[model samples]
Target: MSDPSLVLHRIPETLVEALMMSLRKSKVEELQLRTSVLKPKSKVVVPSMRKLLTTEQSNKASKSVGRKLPVPSNQIRDIVQHHCSNKLTKGAVEAIEVSFEKFFKYLCRDVMAICLHAGKKIVTQADIELVMKRQRFIKDNKSLQILIEQNFPLEYRQLFIPVASSVTLKQRKKN
Candidate 1:
């Protein structure tokens, strides 16, 4: 058997060795963390104006930035042809696209305002219908009103129908 004094000395040495090993491990981990943090990040390269103007690059950039992309000119032309038996010029198609973007922005703003007034964060179809109703589009345009009534859901079409007052009903009954 080992002597008690030797055992006691060995005990302290083993404890010191364990403590040193733990300290070394912590130091190595800390150094690794420091090295990882100190590594240089790759620089972002801004594309040249010419590259940005390219269709493919612009589409990629627009998609990455979550911007509302303009409708393709061909699709716009197709829509114009569908509505009227007339072909639009290149400039006319561009003009229509710009006007559409402006109208959409204006409509979205009004819908968002309605959503906020209703204590909601997300825009809803009901909010858009409310905005359209408030804008008096259905009242002003008979054709558009008819189109909406025909295409839209029953709940949406009900918004445009005038309600008869109780007084009017009573007077009608008396008459």
Candidate 2:
């Protein structure tokens, strides 16, 4: 009778031999397919690397050179009219748009800085809330701070609750 150990060792050897044979067979089949004279039903054409790069660069250049305001003027006008009792002139609307853009840009810079400082590549809601909280404390504009708090009160609560829970979990683990 064959020993159990011998049977186990022979089984693995057979498996390895079978695996090698299948690999060789597949490789030979691939080579034959490559060398065959039959043409593919459809031809694929790949653009040259340089041509692709140049086109991409030109597209980016055009986009950056002729960039429009982030928010449309008409939309800003609509928002202003919806909120304000008085109708603002076109120049006032334009000024609001410009100032809004500047403020938005500044906020984005702060959020990005916070994300980087936290050793995270993607900016999460938590990062934004942290920046907003800091900004709320620092800014003297009560109206703007109140507006932010009102608009995202629930979001801020949801983000912070999870963070507090995580801290408690870590403390428990330590204990």
Candidate 3:
């Protein structure tokens, strides 16, 4: 079979100049030839490429995702909308919601218990403090105090010093 003559054609000077300038600007000597080569070299994404996702590709991808179920009626989607605004895998969003729901349940239970015990309609910061005081888990212990300080919120930064000092004072021999 006669090898097809490799045609060496001169691209129009204007086009070649444009391509050379673009190559220089892009800091690459040559671009690989494909649909990408035909794209107008620019910082912006190629508009044509953006539109190249064929209906078949779209259909196959959409089909695999399964249809979104109708939004639930009870919960205002607005509350969760921020959490869901960004693109996330289905499982990731489910896990995050599950985690937040668990945390919220624990927080509400603690608040409710304090409110019930106090016989007060309005739960305040003092109620939270009182609960913290009564709690046997890691409230006054120095090692646990340091662990809580490192891990938990720094709302009461001064509380750590007092807690550590109180532990030392209790251990000291009084005159």
Best by TM-score: 1
Global lDDT of model 3: 0.53
Question: Lowest summed-lDDT stretch of 10 residues in model 1?
Answer: 43-52
- Strongest candidate by lDDT: 2
Off by over 4 Å in 2: 1-67, 137-175
Candidate 3: deviation at residue 47, Å? 52
lDDT of 3 by residue, 81-159 (tens): 4335565565665555555656556666887898997799998866765655655444655445565455433333345
Candidate 3: TM-score? 0.28
Give all candidates' CA lDDT scores: 0.64, 0.66, 0.53
Lowest lDDT 10-residue stretch of candidate 2: 44-53
lDDT string for model 2 (18-81, tens) is 8767766776666556555465453433322232246779867654663267667776676567
Better of 1 and 3 by TM-score: 1
- State residue 25's C-alpha deviation in candidate 2, in Å: 74
Pitting candidate 2 against candidate 3, the one with the higher lDDT is 2
